[model samples]
Each structure stands twice: as C-alpha cells, then as structure tokens.
Target chain A: MIRHHLSDALLMGYSAGQLPEAFNLVVASHISMCDECRARLASFDAVGGALLDASVDDLGESDAAVPESSLAATMARIRAAGPVERTRPQVAPRRGLLPAPLSRYVGGDLDAIRWKPVGGGVRQAILPTDKAASARLLFIPAGAAVPDHGHRGTELTLVLQGAFSDASERFGPGDLEIATAADEHSPVAEQGMDCICLAATDAPLKFNTLLPRMLQPFLRI
Target chain B: MVRSESVTRADKPGEASVSKLVGKDEMNGTAEWVAEMLLVASNSDEAAFAHLFGHFGPRVKAFLIKSGTEPAVAEECMQEVMATVWQKAHMFDPARASVATWIFTIARNRRIDILRRSRRPEPEDLPWGPEPEADPADAVSLQQESRILGEALKDLPDKQRELIEKAYFGDMTHGEIARVTGLPLGTIKSRIRLALEKLRQSMT
Candidate 1:
C-alpha cells in the first residue's frame, strides 16, 4: 500500500490538463500505484465536469454558438470512424518495476532502460519533456548516497524499486517524497538492494557540495 | 455538507437562492442525458447521439476556445470528441461517472492533444469491465451529488469561483494554482470518496 500520494494542486492540474508533461508523467505513474489518489483525481475531474455542464447564460457568455451544420458533420465523422469493439473484461496489465505510464516513456520494463553514470554509484537517464520541467530515472547502488542538494522549485521523487531513506523518512516502493525549495538533504539508498526512482523537478537542483555543484551544469541534474 | 462549505458570503445572495430553486431541474436534466447516452451505447441510436451533440457540442467548443485554442481548431476538435463519444459509447458507465462528466474527460483530453502537442499520460485503468448494466439507484444518487456540487460552485464568492474557473480554463499554471486558491474542496473530496466506496462495492 502506498503511503504518500500526490498533492491536491498536482491532481487538479492534471485533471484540468494544465500541468507540464514531466509533471503529468509523474502524476500518472503515481496514480497508477495508488488507488486513493486515483479516486481523488477522478473527483477533480468531476469538478471539470461540473464546469462543462454549466449553462451559457450562467457563464454569462452569449457568444459560444456552434454552427447549424455541426451536429450533421459530427454524425458524418462518426460514420467514417467505424464501429467500436464490444466491451471486454479488461484486467490491468501486470505491473513490473515501472508502472504502465512510465513504461510507455521507457518503451518497456526495467531492463529496457538505458542508464548512464552521473557520478559515484548513481546512474540517471533524463526523460524527454518540455522545457517547463525535467523528469529522470535514478539508480543508486545499495548503501550509496546522493550528494546533498536543495531544490530551486519543486522536486517529486517516487520510489519504483528498493528503498531510499532521506532525512525525513524511508520511502519504499510507491511512496512519494515531494521536496520543495526549503528542503535540502542527501537521500541514501537503503541496504540490501539498489534503489531506482522516478524523479521530476521543475527547476534545476542546487548541490550543497562544490564538486557536485560544478558537475550540475554538465550532468543537467 | 457540500453546501455549507461554499455557502459563505455569496456576492449575489438572491442569485444563489434562485439557483437552489432550479437544482431539481438540473438533476432531471442530468438523468435525461444519462438515459440518452445509454440509448446510444446500446443501439447506436443516431437520434440519441444527435441530442447529446446538440447539448454538449457548443459547450465543448466554448470550453476549447476558452482554453486558448483557435475557434476553428476548437470546432474541429469538438467534432472528433463527439465522434469518440459515439465510437466508445459502450464504455460509458453511469454508475461510475455521469454523462456530462464522461464527456468532459474526453474534451479535456482532446484539448491537450490539439494544443499542447504532448502526450497526457493516463493512470492504468482499474481492472474492471464496463457496467453490465448501470445500477439505477447508484446512478440517481451520483447525479444528485453532482447537482449539489454544481450549486455549491455557483454559491462560492466571485473571487473564489473565478480562481477555480481560471485553473480549469488554463489561465493558471500548476504553480500558480498552489498560490492562488485554497479551493473549497472539502465537499468535492467527500463526494468523491463516497462515489469511490460505492464503486469498490460494485467491483466486488
């Protein structure tokens, strides 16, 4: 069972289709693992639904008129689209180390990931997303620790494999740690197994150590 | 419970009371649309599809345009959205989502695709088939809750309501939403939990 879940702001932004691509991916991945967040996200969607159901007069907009032939055109489009398949009982595909949404970006499961060493025993692969934010998969060897760092904007880290313990708490699989600007610490991979995480940041991180800070420009961490 | 959270200091108190009086009509309207959607799902009924299109098409277009899509593009996307509704009508589950809520999800997805040029990752589907048949009692209760939620939205103070609308219409970024509005979400959250409990039972 997942302990930490997404914030309301993230959920609502996702429901409204307004979050950055990287943030959306993280939210989607987390929701895949957490039923509580899934239900909460649906609630946020219902808000969007409520807004859509509003009458033209209620919104005080007299100008949102569709053309007379629009319905006929949609009907024509429907005919061209062909019939839908009969509804089938869909069991969710078995979840691997990566959730379904993350798998789409990686193209497969954990073995499919292409990892590059950032430094020390940590490896990272930056996923392609818009300029607004960055998402990456992180691999930290057992008993290793990332350099101390502070965030410029917000950092969302979701544990996908093994466990990691930071100053705050131990984050096992499906637990999300949302670190804001005020937080600064090094997260160490717990003993026994390598820790792999999906982490997204809206802004660049500030490494506390001078060496790591210098490497930041080249590493894009 | 949904009402009390939003009943604070309505700018137009008279208008708030007026909407309360019409709440019954809104609930009836939702039920009628749900029935119409079922007809389309079961029989591929053109008449029912057309009726749904008549009510929702303009609203969807307006929604897209408000989100800053060009009017022509919005109209085109609106057509695609309606087509998807027809093609995927068999997936409609009134026990889980009202017809308007279902359509809103489609419109939101289309808006993201046409404007953002980015993939919107969706959560994995809950392991379940479409309702073999919608539960009438569950459907009505869900509809009633949604109507009350809508009224609560209208009764919100203008500033609060506008902030919520701005978040939905793409005027506010996710970061901005964190700063701009502590939304009146107590009621909405409870309603969702209620719906989720019902859904969980049906799954079993």
Candidate 2:
C-alpha cells in the first residue's frame, strides 16, 4: 500500500491548473501510481465543475454575456479545422520504472535517461520544466545515502523503484514524501535494490556539505 | 475532521433544500446535455453542437474573463474550448464526469495555457482494454450527484463561496486557499470526498 500521498494543497493546485510545471509533473507521476489520489483529484475537479455550473446561473443575475457572433465564429473555426476522425481513448502501457507522464519527458524509460554523476554513488537527470521550478530523476545505488539537506521551498519526492528511509519514515515504490522549508534530512537507499526517485522542488536544496554546495551551481540542483 | 463536514452535507441535504436548489428542470437539462454530447460524438450533429454552444458558450466566456483574461482573448479562448469539446467528445465518459465537469476541465487547461503559458501535466489516463458502453444507470446517478454538489455550493456562506471561487478563477494560490478561507481546506475537500466515494462505489 502507498503510505504517502499528494497533499490537499498540491492536489487542489493541480486541479486548478495553478502549480508550476515541475510540481505538476510530480503530482501527475504520483497519481499515475496511486489510484486513491487519482480519485481524490477527481473530487477536486468536480468542485470546478460545480463552480462552472453555478457561474452560468449567476450570469443571468449578473451582466456578463457571450457576444452574439460567438457561436457562428466558433462553428466557422470548427469547420476550418476540417473533419476529425473519432477514435477510442488508447491504452498507454506503463514503460518499465517510469509512468506515462514521466516517460514522455524522458522520451522513454530507465535506459533512455541521460545520467550525470553527481558524486558519491548517486546520479541525476534533470527533466526540462519551466523556470518557476525544477524536476529531476535521482538514481541511488543500494546502500548509498543522499547527502543531508534542507529544503528552501516545498519538495516532493516520489519513489518510483525500490525504497528509501529518512529519519521520519520509510517510503517504498508508489509512496510520495512531501518536505517543506522547515524539513531537513538524510535519505539512504534500502539494501535490497537500487532506488530511483522523481523529485521536484520550487527552490534549491540547502546542502550542508561544502563540496555539494560548490557543485550545486554546476549541477543546478 | 474535514470528513465530518462532508458527512453532514451528504446526510442532511434537506437542511440546505438541495432538492429545491437543483429543481426538476435543471435535472432534466443535465440529461439533455449528455444526450446532445452523445449525438455530437456518434453523428457529428451540428444542431446538437449548436445547442451545446448556446447553453455553455457564454458561461465559458465569463469563466475566462473572471480568470483575468482579456475580453478579446477570452472570446477567442472560449471558441477554442468549444471546438475541442467537439473534437474530444468521443472521450466523454458520463459515468466518470458530467458534461459541465468535463467542460470545466477543458476550460481550466485553456486558462492555464493562455494565462500561465505553461504546460499542465495530467495524470496518466487509466489503462483499459476494449470496453463496453458505459451503463446508463451509472451515468444518471453520477449526474444526479453532480447537481446535488452544485446545490451544496450555493448553500455555502458568501465568504466561503467567494474563497472557493477565487481559487477556481486563478485569483488564489494553493497555499492561500487554507489561509484565506479561514475554514480548513478539509471542509471543502471532505465535501468533494463524499462525492468521490459515491462515484467509486457506482463504478464498482
């Protein structure tokens, strides 16, 4: 069972389409693995639906109106776009290690990643996202430890393969760990298998070590 | 704690006069809209599409404008949203979402694209093989629940409702939602959570 899930704030932000691209990616990747959160996200979307319906009724009481030509113009655009061939929603099989949304960013699964050694036994591949935030896939060998650090802003780390444990708790595959500015910890990979994580952060990590801090500028972590 | 509020809303719909709020006519209209979407999907019926536009077009336009979009751009975005409704009608699953809910999602994405100019990554679509038609009973029950939820929103206090509206209108951030609303996010979340549980039970 997945112990950790997306917070109400993050889920609602995603449902509202307000989160940064990197955060959105992490939220989507987590949902791809956790159905409970998927259902919860649907509930949030339903609220948006409720508001949209209410606004229509409010429009009659208020002064807002659609221009008279709006329908004709929209129909014209539809015609210009030409015929659309209807197709059923296709099934997207999960590629190994990565979910569909994450895979799209990496262009494929584990082997597709272009890994760069970040010292220690840890490697990372930064996924392209908007400037507001950053997302990267971290690969930690079995029994390896990520350096101790604190978050400058909110950080979301989803274990996609294997498991990891920090001072707080253990996070297995499909589990998400949400750390805020107040949190600081060192995470070590479990002994049985290598741990691969999709992690996103709004601000850079506050590394405790001088070496990692020096490499931070070059690594863009 | 928020779960308690949702239970109250679900168990005591009559206190809010939710039945009266939805009204018979509104319930019928919901079903009618679903049928029209099916017509668009199966027959590519222009008349049905026009009917949908006549009802939802102004609302979508207003939604865009409220979210800080310029009037001219809002008009254009509304057009694209409607066109997309036509193109993706085949994907509509009444068992999962009402027409308004589906349209709201499309509009929300459009708002992000225009207002934020950033990508909005969606959860992977649930993988399923060739499927049978969605059960009509499931669809009807789900739509009924949606109307009840809409009525419940109308019953919220003005401050609470406005806070919720601001979030949807893109005027509030996620962190601000709990702070500005004063009431815990759980209250709103629990309310929606009830609806989700019902939806899951029906699907099963």
Candidate 3:
C-alpha cells in the first residue's frame, strides 16, 4: 500500500490547485482508485467554491498577449470535430505509454469485442481473461445501469463514452474507476445518452437477485 | 498516528512561525483568482492572457532568482514559461489546478532545464552558481502565503530544505541533489520525503 493518506490538507491542496505537478498526478491517479479520497476532494471543491463566492478582486493579472486568429481557428477546427465516439474503441495506441500494470488490460485491439445486450439497453462484451482475471466492457444507453450486483474481487472500469454517476461522483470519458472488493456501488448512465465503459474484473459478480445469481455462473462477467 | 509524531517534530518550528504570518482566508482568495484567470485564458481571451502575464511574469522571474538563477537567465526562463502558456493554454483544466500553480510548474520545469544545461563545463567559460538569492526585502513584499511559505522554508533544517529546493526549484534529480549536497542517495530521498510531509502539514 502507498504510504500516503488522503488528508483534508491534501484534498484542499488539490482542489485549491497547490500541489507540485508530480504530486498532483499521483493524487489524481490515487483518487481514481480510492472513492474515499474522491469524496473528500469533492468536499474540498465545495469549500473552495464557497470561498471564491465570498471573495472579490483578490488575484493579480499578468500582461501577456493572446493568440491571434490563427490559434482561434485551430481550436475551432478541433472543437468542430466533435467528441471521439466509440462504446469501446480500440485502446488508444498510447496504451504503451502508460505504466506497465495499466497497459496489460488495454493492450489488445479494443474494437473486436462482440457486444451483447444484457439489460437496460446496455451492451456488454466480456473479454476473455488470459489467466484467472476477467475483464468486460459495458455500453449503456443514457441513464441506464447494469443489474444490481457487487464484485467478488478487483474491478477496473474506464469510461469510454458519455458520462455516468454513482451515489458519489460523476465520471466522464477517459476517467478510470478502480473498484476493489470492499466497494459496492451501482453506476447509472446520465440521461439523454448512452454510457460506454471498459471494465476489468478479477472475479464473478454477486447479484442481489437469486435469478441473476444463478445466471452469474453461466455469464462470462 | 504513529508516523504523525515523527513528522510533527520536523514541522513544529516552521509551522508555528509561518502560521503567524498569513490568514487562511487571504490564501484562499489568491488561489481562487488564479483559477479564474486560467479559465478565462483557456477560453482564448487575449485580454485575459495579458492580465495574467502582467501579474505573474514578475513573480515567476522573482522565484527563479531566489532559486539561484542570474537575472538574465531568470528573465529568459520567464519569457519561455509565458510562451508555453500561449502555446498550451488549452491544456489548462480548472478542475485540475489553479493558474498560478500551473504557471509555477511551467516555470519550475524551465528553471530545471536551464540548470541542467549549465551543469556542463563549457570550453570557453565556466557556469557560476545561480544568481544570488533574490533581494530579501523584495521577497518579503509577496503575498502573505508566499511570505509564510518562505519563512517556513527557512525554519526547516537547512540540509532538508536544500535538498528539496534543489530537487523542486532547481529541477535536480535525486542523484544530482545527492552529488551537490554530499549526502548519500538514500539520505537525500529520506530528507525529501520528510520535507514534503512537513510542508504538507504546515500548509494545512
């Protein structure tokens, strides 16, 4: 385990944007895996918001020239291209650039998975596990959720499309969720669109319902 | 709490001294303003960029000077940092960090690059130590948080803060800090770890 604990000071530093770059990256990565930290950060954000609302004319302004039409045009072009679409697009070629353990799940061609509808109009492709570990990708219609269930072991999910929120925080595209054995939360895709996520699991699901529990044995994830 | 006690011992003097210098409310305000400016700049507002540059450019230059860079080199690094701001403004994410924090990071990285380049022995001329620490009076004129941080920094056992300043402000790697400080690599790492923990506690 990492020696660091997510304290209020760290959360405030993160939300107020005071951490060193390397430290910030470490905290960001940690928050992805640790919901407790995420919740604390959210609280810090609230405090920051309240503080900002009460203050006025506090920060100094620097005099730097803004880019001309050339930069503006480039940004407009990129924005017009629209958001990248793919319920489970191929693991970006940048997967190699990630740390080793993270790269393992994203190594293969991500587009090849066969998506099958499970429930709530969500499609899932249970990726074949190389060893004892199991991984799956879920594509949920807007405001949908998988059957209510809990994980038996570690489950890592990365949002590939749209956004989703559980009881705690909302995750957008490129956001990762690393859930361990103790975490038990169900996420619902935001309204008006579908949410697609890449999920890697180490064990089978523990469905709340007896019927789904029976089906879990036959199901791949 | 087992580890907390040892950490508290390192920070006690610095924390007490710095706490008297600044109010938490003022620091919060400064942080918020920086975040707002960053948001405006990211939106492609030329005026906003100018406002930010005017305010932060000198601060960045001053920080470099304190880190031991010559005025000329500090000015160059400041310009480079602003140029990066212009080029990578879109990468600014308010959710991630405030503008001052982001600019400081850029400045820190640039300072590191300059120091690294200076480390090589030039055939014609030898590199000198970084410009003398910035004027103590000028350093004092900064915001309360900066003053507090600077004071707290001074209160740290010199050996520990020196390694930290070299690694962070000077951008020296662990091995380089070890070489300059004449401490073992493991010792340097332990000092930094302890220093960071102390800094975190003091800030709280």
Tell me the TM-score of each prediction against the true structure.
0.88, 0.87, 0.32
Q: Which candidate is the best by lDDT?
A: 2
lDDT of 3 by residue, A44-137 (tens): 3433322222112212222222223424443344346553231212222233222222223345444545678665587887644343455566
* DockQ-based CAPRI category assigned to the predicted complex of candidate 1: acceptable
Give the best candidate by DockQ: 1
Put down candidate 3 lDDT per residue, B46-143, tens digits, no spaces: 55455555556666666666567787666666666766665566444333334554566566556646765321110111111122222222212222
Per residue, candidate 2 scores C-alpha lDDT tens digits across A55-166 of: 7676573434777888888889989999988887666466588888999999998999999999898999999999889999999999999999999888899999999999
lDDT for each residue of candidate 1 in A58-137, tens digit (9 for 90 to 100): 54454567888988898888778776775745766566778888998998999999999988989999898887889999
> DockQ of all candidates, in order?
0.44, 0.40, 0.03
- Candidates by DockQ, descending order: 1, 2, 3
Between candidates 2 and 3, the one scoring higher on DockQ is 2
Runs with alpha carbons beyond 4 Å of true place in candidate 2: A57-63, B1-26, B178-204
What lDDT does each candidate get? 0.78, 0.78, 0.47
Q: Clashes in model 2: which pairs?
A: none
Q: What is the lDDT of residue A99 in candidate 2?
A: 89
